[model samples]
Target: MARVVWHVPVTTSGPGSTTALRLFRLRDGRRCAVGFSSPAALAALLGPDQAHTELGEPALHALTTPLGVDVLVLDPRLVAPPVTAPATPAAPAPTALLQHR
Candidate 1:
Protein backbone atom coordinates (compact mmCIF):
# COMPACT_ATOMS: atom_id res chain seq x y z
CA MET A 1 0.00 0.00 0.00
CA ALA A 2 1.17 3.52 -0.76
CA ARG A 3 1.80 5.87 2.14
CA VAL A 4 0.40 9.37 1.93
CA VAL A 5 0.80 12.17 4.46
CA TRP A 6 -1.39 15.08 5.43
CA HIS A 7 -0.49 17.99 7.66
CA VAL A 8 -2.56 20.62 9.45
CA PRO A 9 -1.71 23.13 12.15
CA VAL A 10 -3.31 22.65 15.56
CA THR A 11 -5.81 25.16 16.82
CA THR A 12 -5.33 27.18 19.99
CA SER A 13 -8.44 25.71 21.67
CA GLY A 14 -6.77 22.31 22.12
CA PRO A 15 -3.23 22.73 23.25
CA GLY A 16 -0.81 20.03 24.41
CA SER A 17 -3.32 17.31 23.62
CA THR A 18 -3.44 14.71 20.89
CA THR A 19 -6.06 12.33 19.51
CA ALA A 20 -6.08 9.51 16.98
CA LEU A 21 -8.94 7.92 15.05
CA ARG A 22 -8.36 4.73 13.11
CA LEU A 23 -9.87 3.64 9.81
CA PHE A 24 -9.81 0.32 7.97
CA ARG A 25 -10.41 -0.65 4.38
CA LEU A 26 -10.98 -4.38 4.77
CA ARG A 27 -11.89 -6.36 7.87
CA ASP A 28 -8.26 -7.33 8.23
CA GLY A 29 -6.69 -4.52 6.27
CA ARG A 30 -4.10 -2.29 7.86
CA ARG A 31 -5.90 0.30 9.99
CA CYS A 32 -4.70 3.86 10.44
CA ALA A 33 -5.76 6.57 12.86
CA VAL A 34 -5.64 10.30 12.32
CA GLY A 35 -4.47 12.07 15.49
CA PHE A 36 -4.89 15.65 16.58
CA SER A 37 -3.05 17.43 19.35
CA SER A 38 -6.35 17.91 21.17
CA PRO A 39 -10.05 17.44 20.74
CA ALA A 40 -10.59 21.20 20.75
CA ALA A 41 -7.83 21.59 18.24
CA LEU A 42 -9.31 18.88 16.04
CA ALA A 43 -12.72 20.43 16.43
CA ALA A 44 -11.38 23.86 15.59
CA LEU A 45 -9.65 22.49 12.54
CA LEU A 46 -12.56 20.34 11.34
CA GLY A 47 -15.19 22.71 12.70
CA PRO A 48 -17.11 22.16 15.97
CA ASP A 49 -20.13 20.41 14.43
CA GLN A 50 -18.01 18.02 12.41
CA ALA A 51 -15.72 17.29 15.35
CA HIS A 52 -18.62 16.01 17.45
CA THR A 53 -19.79 13.81 14.59
CA GLU A 54 -16.27 12.59 13.81
CA LEU A 55 -15.68 11.44 17.38
CA GLY A 56 -19.01 9.62 17.58
CA GLU A 57 -18.79 7.97 14.15
CA PRO A 58 -16.86 4.72 13.83
CA ALA A 59 -15.47 5.01 10.28
CA LEU A 60 -15.47 8.83 9.92
CA HIS A 61 -18.09 9.11 7.22
CA ALA A 62 -16.59 12.36 5.92
CA LEU A 63 -13.33 10.76 4.91
CA THR A 64 -14.97 8.01 2.90
CA THR A 65 -17.82 10.25 1.86
CA PRO A 66 -15.48 12.52 -0.08
CA LEU A 67 -13.01 9.80 -1.03
CA GLY A 68 -12.47 6.09 -0.44
CA VAL A 69 -9.29 6.74 1.53
CA ASP A 70 -9.04 6.35 5.30
CA VAL A 71 -8.14 9.14 7.69
CA LEU A 72 -5.13 8.62 9.93
CA VAL A 73 -3.55 10.80 12.59
CA LEU A 74 0.21 10.59 12.77
CA ASP A 75 2.73 11.68 15.32
CA PRO A 76 4.01 15.25 15.06
CA ARG A 77 7.55 13.93 14.86
CA LEU A 78 6.62 12.12 11.67
CA VAL A 79 5.82 15.46 10.07
CA ALA A 80 8.48 17.21 8.00
CA PRO A 81 10.36 20.19 9.40
CA PRO A 82 9.04 23.57 8.40
CA VAL A 83 10.92 25.45 5.71
CA THR A 84 11.73 28.92 7.01
CA ALA A 85 14.40 31.55 6.94
CA PRO A 86 16.30 32.68 10.00
CA ALA A 87 14.79 35.76 11.65
CA THR A 88 16.78 38.92 11.07
CA PRO A 89 16.85 42.07 13.13
CA ALA A 90 14.92 44.90 11.62
CA ALA A 91 16.93 47.90 10.48
CA PRO A 92 16.28 51.17 12.30
CA ALA A 93 14.13 53.68 10.48
CA PRO A 94 15.98 56.57 8.87
CA THR A 95 16.01 59.75 10.96
CA ALA A 96 13.44 62.41 9.99
CA LEU A 97 16.26 64.84 9.16
CA LEU A 98 17.60 62.35 6.62
CA GLN A 99 14.29 62.39 4.78
CA HIS A 100 13.80 64.84 1.87
CA ARG A 101 11.18 67.03 3.55
Candidate 2:
Protein backbone atom coordinates (compact mmCIF):
# COMPACT_ATOMS: atom_id res chain seq x y z
CA MET A 1 0.00 0.00 0.00
CA ALA A 2 1.13 3.56 -0.74
CA ARG A 3 1.86 5.93 2.13
CA VAL A 4 -0.52 8.77 2.82
CA VAL A 5 0.60 12.00 1.17
CA TRP A 6 0.30 15.45 2.75
CA HIS A 7 -0.32 18.76 1.05
CA VAL A 8 2.72 21.02 1.09
CA PRO A 9 2.55 24.69 0.09
CA VAL A 10 4.85 26.05 -2.61
CA THR A 11 5.64 29.49 -4.07
CA THR A 12 6.21 30.32 -7.74
CA SER A 13 7.05 33.67 -9.24
CA GLY A 14 5.11 33.01 -12.43
CA PRO A 15 4.21 30.41 -15.02
CA GLY A 16 7.13 28.12 -16.00
CA SER A 17 9.10 29.52 -13.08
CA THR A 18 10.85 27.29 -10.61
CA THR A 19 8.87 26.53 -7.45
CA ALA A 20 10.12 26.73 -3.92
CA LEU A 21 8.78 25.10 -0.81
CA ARG A 22 7.22 27.67 1.46
CA LEU A 23 8.67 27.54 4.95
CA PHE A 24 7.30 29.06 8.13
CA ARG A 25 8.82 30.32 11.34
CA LEU A 26 7.68 29.39 14.75
CA ARG A 27 6.91 32.00 17.41
CA ASP A 28 10.35 31.34 18.82
CA GLY A 29 11.94 32.25 15.45
CA ARG A 30 12.76 28.68 14.53
CA ARG A 31 12.16 27.64 10.95
CA CYS A 32 9.76 24.84 10.16
CA ALA A 33 7.68 23.29 7.40
CA VAL A 34 3.89 23.01 7.18
CA GLY A 35 1.73 20.25 5.78
CA PHE A 36 -2.00 19.65 5.58
CA SER A 37 -3.95 16.44 5.36
CA SER A 38 -6.02 17.58 2.43
CA PRO A 39 -6.31 20.39 -0.12
CA ALA A 40 -9.35 21.82 1.65
CA ALA A 41 -7.44 21.95 4.91
CA LEU A 42 -4.54 23.72 3.23
CA ALA A 43 -6.85 26.30 1.65
CA ALA A 44 -8.71 26.95 4.90
CA LEU A 45 -5.64 28.38 6.61
CA LEU A 46 -3.78 29.78 3.61
CA GLY A 47 -6.81 30.87 1.56
CA PRO A 48 -8.16 29.41 -1.67
CA ASP A 49 -5.39 30.90 -3.82
CA GLN A 50 -2.52 29.12 -2.08
CA ALA A 51 -0.50 26.73 -4.27
CA HIS A 52 0.41 23.34 -2.87
CA THR A 53 1.89 19.96 -3.78
CA GLU A 54 1.53 16.50 -2.36
CA LEU A 55 4.27 14.52 -0.66
CA GLY A 56 4.56 11.71 1.77
CA GLU A 57 5.53 12.38 5.37
CA PRO A 58 9.04 11.02 4.88
CA ALA A 59 9.54 13.09 1.76
CA LEU A 60 8.39 16.26 3.48
CA HIS A 61 10.86 15.68 6.29
CA ALA A 62 13.71 14.84 3.97
CA LEU A 63 13.26 18.04 1.98
CA THR A 64 13.07 20.31 5.04
CA THR A 65 15.75 18.65 7.17
CA PRO A 66 18.47 19.73 4.77
CA LEU A 67 17.53 23.37 5.28
CA GLY A 68 17.78 23.26 9.12
CA VAL A 69 14.02 22.96 9.33
CA ASP A 70 13.37 19.90 11.47
CA VAL A 71 9.95 20.70 12.79
CA LEU A 72 6.81 19.94 10.90
CA VAL A 73 3.54 21.59 11.83
CA LEU A 74 0.52 19.60 10.77
CA ASP A 75 -2.82 21.36 10.77
CA PRO A 76 -1.59 24.34 12.70
CA ARG A 77 -4.07 26.66 14.36
CA LEU A 78 -4.17 30.40 13.70
CA VAL A 79 -2.25 32.17 16.43
CA ALA A 80 -1.87 35.67 15.03
CA PRO A 81 -4.54 38.30 14.57
CA PRO A 82 -6.02 38.95 11.15
CA VAL A 83 -4.46 41.79 9.15
CA THR A 84 -6.53 44.95 8.57
CA ALA A 85 -6.00 47.91 6.27
CA PRO A 86 -4.62 51.07 7.82
CA ALA A 87 -6.95 54.06 8.15
CA THR A 88 -6.10 56.88 5.74
CA PRO A 89 -6.89 60.55 6.40
CA ALA A 90 -9.41 62.17 4.11
CA ALA A 91 -8.04 64.72 1.59
CA PRO A 92 -8.91 68.38 2.03
CA ALA A 93 -11.08 70.11 -0.55
CA PRO A 94 -9.30 72.17 -3.21
CA THR A 95 -9.39 75.98 -2.80
CA ALA A 96 -9.72 78.42 -5.73
CA LEU A 97 -6.88 81.00 -6.18
CA LEU A 98 -7.79 84.73 -6.70
CA GLN A 99 -6.17 86.54 -9.69
CA HIS A 100 -4.37 89.88 -9.08
CA ARG A 101 -5.64 92.79 -11.18
Per-residue lDDT of candidate 1, residues 53-83 (tens digit):
2232234445444455554443323334678
lDDT of 2 at 81: 87
Whole-model Cα lDDT per candidate? 0.44, 0.92
Candidate 1 Cα misplacement greater than 4 A, ranges = 1-37, 43-53, 61-66, 74-78, 86-101
Q: What is the C-alpha RMSD, rounded to one decimal, of candidate 2?
A: 5.0
The candidate that achieves the highest lDDT relative to the unseen native structure: 2
Q: How many collisions per candidate?
A: 8, 0
Q: What's the TM-score of every candidate structure? A: 0.26, 0.77
Model 2, 1-80: lDDT tens per residue?
96888899999989999999999999999998999999999999999999999989899999999899999999887889
| Candidate 1 global lDDT | 0.44
- Predicted structure 2: clash tally: 0
